[model samples]
Target chain A: MQDKPFMSSLTTDEVATSLRRKGRWGLGEVLFWLAAAATLFFLPERHLILNEIAIIGLFAVSLDLILGYAGIVSLGHAAFFGVGAYVAGIFAKEMTGDPLTGLAVAGVAAALLGFATSFLVLRGADLTRLMVTLGVALVAGEIANQASWLTGGADGLQGIMMGPLLGMFEFDIFGTTAYAYSLVVLFVLFVVARRIVHSPFGLSLRSIRDNSLRARAVGIPVNRRLVAIYTISAAYAGIAGGLLAQTTQFVSLDVLAFHRSADVLLVLVIGGVGYLYGGLIGAVIFKVLQDILSSMTPQYWQFWIGLILVVLVLAGRERLTERARFLAGRLFGRSAGAPRTAPAREGRP
Target chain B: MTPALETIGLQKRFGGLTATDNVSFRLEKGARHALIGPNGAGKTTFINLLTGVIPPTSGRILLEGADITRLCPELRVQRGLARTFQINQLFPAMTPLETLGLAVSERKGSGRDWWRVFGSDREIVDEVVGIAQRFRLADVLDERTSNLPYGKQRLLEIAVAFACEPRVLLLDEPAAGVPEAERHELLATVAALPRDVSVLLIEHDMDLVFSFAERISVLVNGGLFTEGTVDEIAADPRVRAVYLGESVDE
Candidate 1:
């Protein structure tokens, strides 16, 4: 018991974080998080926008775990999200309508699916992983299309009667229950992920990304760690999907579409990599830009989104967070020391 | 007594070339053995065979007298056998302390958990710090490993390996890319490791080879050409001609 680190837990890193709060999640990140959270509360009758941002943020953050932390660049991440959504819908329809249970089912089901396909991902490069994962999602969409009685197919499963959450909090027609419910889930997962990222295991994943052969020689088992993280990321993605389904009380083939995965990636890149708050910032930017652009001209809305994405790419998405950190240091009057997280995959090796 | 690490009839072939041919070697419980050879010699291939990186064509590897020819690299590490590489394998994105922490965790046999930040045992953390400090990596504990000086990277790699607390440490050219000035410090660190921890150093630097090793094994072509004490190998006329430079091949 004394030898086991997880068991004998007199935490020093917590103390480190407290004593030196000048690390990577510096003042700038703190402000960005506050501003993002404040948007939900302050927005005037923009609940729909808020809801979309929250869901997409969770999805993107989940993707970022594998992408940024683990170096698994998956292009078909939407499959897990779609699977979660379908699982939630199925659970609500057949079993208990408990949002918690539905979310769990969605996550578990997606995790299982992810686990099964993880082997395919293990062998290939990012391009292969992308094509295979997206292929799975495309196939799944087709399956849902065929299983109209089960999944409601292309038209989507409808006539869902979602009972009160926890049998106490009733859902409103304004989508207040769904929005509030999803937001809480997102917050808890975010905090949990934050803790994970800062942990020793997380540090190893960064190492694996740095140089895998070197990691192996140092006695770090590269493949096993990658698989374990892949499964966990899948579970997170699955839960994200479930949350969407449970909130909307609907599941559709579109949930499994390639666009969803691509969009989640866009959100992650836009917000920032490595920083957990990046998801929220990226999601808000995407959703708001989407809204403002679409309203300007209902036709060719995607054209505007594509143009913004191009601009973001040209501006260097990573620079946004860097500039913010510089600004935060200036404004907060705290000397932000060097970033705690070393850049992932940075050295030309 | 069975050797701490022994390879019997170990053979490795790459396509038409036999890189390692029936190489047999033994390291006692505390043997500071040096495996040395000239360029094109199968010294690295032999190390790989012993470590199970490349499966032998027909041979058996016994760790602490137990057969481990079929075991994978991680499994061997778990069996108290660890190695450093010919090339420094430090994680570029990680500082020495963090890299040490990961090595410590792997040795503890814990699968990675993402949510497990800030609760590692104090003893383990202390041990990690001790290893880093000893390697002179305390200053670069938070700096990215790539940013460290070239010599420091070598030290950091050794520190990461040290965290494993292995019974048999296979160091593949520990001083390969090190500056002459820092080579002594590197040698001193290797010399100071626990007596019970046996070392197999594959070094081309004879100064380091002679300084740290008690007994030396020489590899030539693709086989064990000679095995003897430093004085004997240096004195052997045959070894001098083919390897020890005591005699000219001409």
Candidate 2:
């Protein structure tokens, strides 16, 4: 062991360096958000595709809260998504034409559903959670299919008539307004989720995920935290669904489909599950790939997508990124910028 | 006036076998006690029953005179009862700094505050740094728990339990896998614990038990065979015949 006096004196400075903000917004995070905003200015014509990416990004983020942070494997997250879409659709047609009010209604409805059904997740392991979650989405899809009088069944909800966002911006033909709207919603919610995952509550979730038994032994209320995160994630997914419905002025039974749940899970995994930006990056990649491949092949795009996913999985996220950086550095004759997220190496900034 | 922890006729059975057969135990405030027995003598089971990890078949566990027989593990933790595992149960992915920060924050009742930024809690941060220093973990604070040496991991484990600031701490084999060279450091840290927090250590190491425990309880076949001071336990021929002799043979 080293000298006790030197080690004792070194404690405060060393601890501060190590324990300080593990996830504060960096320059890269700021630049990324700014670039996302800049897209509205430059890519006005591609707003429709951008809007889709934004919605999926939000959905992936919602899944990340439970799957990545809290270590809950859910396969029926679309239950809340579908519920939100239907709730928003019904609110617009029957109760209110105001978009914000409808979105709020959708969010609350989905959150209530999440809270009510969260207990099932509390008692089970990964596979059991997956089954229960899948069961919920299945039942929800069945209800939507059978209730023709209320939901329009197979044809989907029609004549949504979403009043202008905040009584100002109309749902336009070019999708500029829709694009901006979803972007803003995604940005705000991302900020909130980002803050949450960096907070003390977020630390507890990580601890619970890493070791539930030890978490409880250390005075953390594991089940309560799980239920809370699950309900919050449901609300987030609900909001994403509401954004989709309002932007498109439509709600299809497909929103509640099992594929929606599985697709979102795939997007999250592609991006990097635990990190917030993983979902965002994953969504953009997934949507852009789907667009290009679907257009080129029109029919066999699934094969291309599956191939890409397999390659990505086989290579692994960190290794692939490192390889990409290494190749870029070698080609450009410039060293890669300090391997992002190596804060300890960089020392106090 | 009340014992820090007391178990009344605690019993546990797994259908055909009674693992802990109506074993009653007690520890006074600030007591340094040890529970020693042969392998599979149900020492872990007894600790589990006491900590509410598993409910006893029938018994009452009183903590500072309040009955906590049916209270959950977390509730027991809140009531100032904490324990370290025989095998360290730490979050493998997290650094010691993160782990200790969490333990400190949770102990101060801020574990559930999702809105508050973790690093901004200066008081909790300071407390965690203090704990890290106390356990000599400041050097490896940034290292992952799983990547740490066995001795450091054991120290971190005890530090985690200590972060809870429990009234009574149950250390289950704190020095089990630590190398001989590091055993002195572990023992010194254990010996330097605050006087207010009563300790009940479960160990197979007689050197540790004999030196540290003021009162020793020798358990045989899930029952308390004897309880006495260090010298008395060493001299007791019945305890020696059943446990100490067998321990030497093994």
**Tens digits of per-residue lDDT for model 1, B50-164:** 7777788988999998999998877787788888888877776556666777787767755365555533456566666666656766656777777988888888777777788
**Candidate 1 lDDT over residue span A1-349, tens digit each:** 0122122222345324432342236554566557656755776377666777789989888887888887887878988898888888888888878888788888899889888888888787868887888888888878888988888877897766677888898877666667777777888888778767776677677777767766676567778778877887888988988888877788778899888988888888777666566777789888888888778887767887787778767776556556766676687655552234325353211
The model with the greatest lDDT is 2
Model 2 CA lDDT for position A266: 87
Q: Which regions in candidate 1 have their CA more than 4 angstroms from the true location?
A: A1-41, A298-301, A311-315, A335-342, A347-349, B110-115, B246-250
The share of true interface contacts that also appear in candidate 2 amounts to 0.63
Residue B173 of model 1, lDDT score? 90
TM-score of 2: 0.95
What interface RMSD, in Å and to 1 decimal, does model 2 have?
4.6
Report the C-alpha lDDT of model 2 over A68-125, residue by residue, as the tens digit: 8888888999999999999999889999889888888999999999999999999878
DockQ (C-alpha based) per candidate is 0.48, 0.54
